[model samples]
Target: MLADAEKNGPKPAPLIEAFRRTWGRMIIGIGAALLGVGGFFLMTTFIISYGTDELGIDKSVMLNATVIGSVVEIVVLVVAGRIADRIGAWTVCAIGGLVTMAVAFPAFWLVDTGKPALVYLGVGLGICALSIPYAPIGAVVSGMFPEAFRYSAVAMSYNLAGVVAGFVPLLATSLTGAANGASWGAALLLMVIAACTAAGSFASGSLMRRERAARPAGDRVEVAV
Candidate 1:
């Protein structure tokens, strides 16, 4: 399938042109990226500061918990990828987002308890939830665009998400402060991101159908491939 795509793919066009041609799917792809990748930033990256600075967990303890969560994430990603392969990427993505949204508040509440075991549990759960969509999102976005500029579209969405996700730690900190030491601020942030991810993931299927309907029959074959 990959070889066939490479052989029959359309000539690469400007990134902007690719986006212009499929703006609806592009927007959905970007929304999916923002939440899927950005949720990871909240779970893994912002977690350290959220633990040590705000929750006052020992830095070493937080680091150890993070390591545990990372291990769990590794396992979950593989499992989720396999599940996505069997059940469908968008289905996995949507399920992941909903789980994350449902768990965000309670996970943060567990972390706020300052118990080491609870900390590990909270972090591990958060990482595992976030990793589900993270596993299948590359396939999701790649499938959103035609071969003509699939690479460009995927790069743009992920990179743009990366750029915004880079600021997530700062945003989490600011929100935490604004809430006057409440963990709900950061939790709300995660829930909001997860909501977007779930919504976008479900919407992507229909968007892909629309894109296929608009494409030439030959070009449409690449989408399924």
Candidate 2:
């Protein structure tokens, strides 16, 4: 099986050529990655801190929520990927982004209520929202580039986004503190980030469609080849 797969695998494209052909789409992918990944990290961080310090939730409860949320995320991720494959990755991601943005404020509001069940519900909803965009992001990024440069372009975009996302925890903490322990400030920031991700996914999808439209039928086949 390994030998057969290796023999049939696609050859890697020259990186320089791939970058030249897909640079614009790569840029859009990076932007989407930054916002989407950053928002996810920020929300997780806020939940941990805010739940413990402000809401006085028990540590065991938070841990249980984390475990359950992880399961929900994995399930949602698979379902989201299947949905994206049937319709379109960008459409799925855009819809996910909108859901995430819409839920940000309410999720925090629920947590602040200091009710255990509501807190768990809020965290679960947030995880589900994050999973929607997270699941289809890889497909969307890969589709932005030709097969030859696909791996390199996708890695670069995702890694760069990871770097940006690394700062989100600190930023969320600082913003929340600045607002005098108000979670709204952090929630608002997350909403903006999620919105940016949605816009980026929408734009990337539009660009991909335009590129396809501009190509001659024969050229499109050749390019894919």
Best by lDDT: 1
Computed on alpha carbons, the lDDT of every model, listed in order, comes to: 0.82, 0.77
Model 2 lDDT, residue 112, Cα? 83
Residue pairs of candidate 1 with colliding backbone atoms: none
Worst 10 residues of 2 by lDDT: 216-225
How far is 101's C-alpha from truth in model 2 (Å)?
0.9
Cα error, residue 127 of model 1, in Å, equals 0.5
For candidate 2, lDDT tens digit of each residue in 5-28? 588875446566657777777678
Give the distance in Å from residue 210's predicted Cα in candidate 2 to where it truly belongs. 3.6
In angstroms, give how far residue 34 of model 1 lies from its true place: 2.1
lDDT of 2: 0.77
